[model samples]
Target: MMQLENLQPYAIVEDGPFLRIIFDHSYISLLVDEKSYQFIPAESSEIFINKELNKVHNLFDVFTFEKGEEILHVTVIDLMHMKQFRTQLQQIIHTFYEKRTMIPVAEVETIVQELEKENILRLIDRAIDEGEEHSFLELTNRLSEYGGKVEE
Candidate 1:
């Protein structure tokens, strides 16, 4: 029996020769024969499934198996879980977009400070060439405040 709460959002789509169930970060493909079904996962996807859903015994756990049945079936519970999972995924994606649209203030401040330090260094170099002792000393002091070193 599969637990509904642990289910993640997925979509079934036709690949060239197989049907693929794609999840947000991974996928499993199914190849059906006359009497049996084969579940296959790409190398990376197998690793992800193993790491994320440790309780999964096989990739076909998404489908229900009954005694004396050769083919796997999707139960009504599976559809309900998929719907709920899709809604949860939609909410999470919306939240991510909202956060991404906000300004990154700290990164902007760091870039501004780096530009200011470079400008001060250039001014200090100009003061040195012009033999302006007071300006050179003042620029050097300001550079020190930014934790920048003047290389000889």
Candidate 2:
């Protein structure tokens, strides 16, 4: 449930208290008979059952959801590890965000030389700042012919 939207980085464990999970500012725990225990990274009822049943003996007719079907013989260690694997997992998440896109910048001096316009330098600067691929390509193609010779 914690992974449905936001993920948590840490978890708390209770030995004899009601099982509960807290994220941010909300609490998700279960209390019964004034006794509860909370498993970090919370798991489903099936995982919990598998854990308890496996401890005494292998469940031959027990339905399991691990592989989408019921299976017998779930190890207690497997259940414990399965319940709290987030601690070993990286919690970094990259949400959808608006960021300034980077446009490929190239020195197009060769294309600027071909432009017959007196403001060739101005045109080149505009092309660089425009951040448009087609515009820069077209400008360079048009200016490729001039190859202005610098007067020594």
Candidate 3:
């Protein structure tokens, strides 16, 4: 089991139509919470690089604008080239986290204040996870038993 601590943080960026991800080491797998993503090599890059590498001749890298239906994949990149172009996303993530620590007290307070607004979202997600398994009456009754107001 890996804690979020086990994985370095990264920021994904795009330039024109190309998406690049830089990671500490060559290890990276894109995902959303539990789902994992695989890499889709660019068609042009694939066709051009086929003479140099055999694996990417016909693979289609997926792109879409849908929720919960996103593709997850492992992307192998030339570390040297991407490093010359941009820092590894993992390094960028680490740097972002690092910069936050140097923030002044007032800025930290502002960040925390904004984070509190996200707590409601967490509560709603919790309700959804638990709501599916229990009847409305049962859940409402349980909530009342625990001194919480419930509304349908």
Best-to-worst order by lDDT is: 1, 3, 2
Better of 1 and 3 by TM-score: 1
Q: Per-residue lDDT for 20-65 in model 2, tens only? A: 2223221222222343323232222221221222231322322122
lDDT of 3 by residue, 1-152 (tens): 11121233233333344333323321333334554443333221111113232122223433221124564332233322244212443454445546755869899877765565354345545667777534544555545544455445
Q: Worst ten-residue run, lDDT, model 3?
A: 42-51
Model 3 spans > 4 angstroms off:
1-102, 132-152
User: lDDT winner among the candidates?
Assistant: 1
lDDT, residue 118, model 3: 52
Residue pairs with backbone overlap in model 2: 17-36, 18-36, 18-37, 19-37, 19-38, 64-70, 114-143, 114-146, 115-143
**Candidate number with the higher TM-score (1 or 2):** 1
- Best candidate according to TM-score: 1
The 0-to-1 C-alpha lDDT of every candidate, in the order given, reads 0.51, 0.33, 0.38
Give candidate 1 regions above 4 Å deviation. 1-101
- Using lDDT as the yardstick, the better of models 2 and 3 is 3
* TM-score between model 3 and native: 0.19
Q: List, residue by residue over 1-152, the lDDT tens digit for candidate 1.
A: 33223333354343343333345432222223423332222221211122233222233434433224453565333433555544554454445446656779898899999999999999999999999999999999999999999999
RMSDs, each prediction?
A: 12.2, 17.1, 19.5
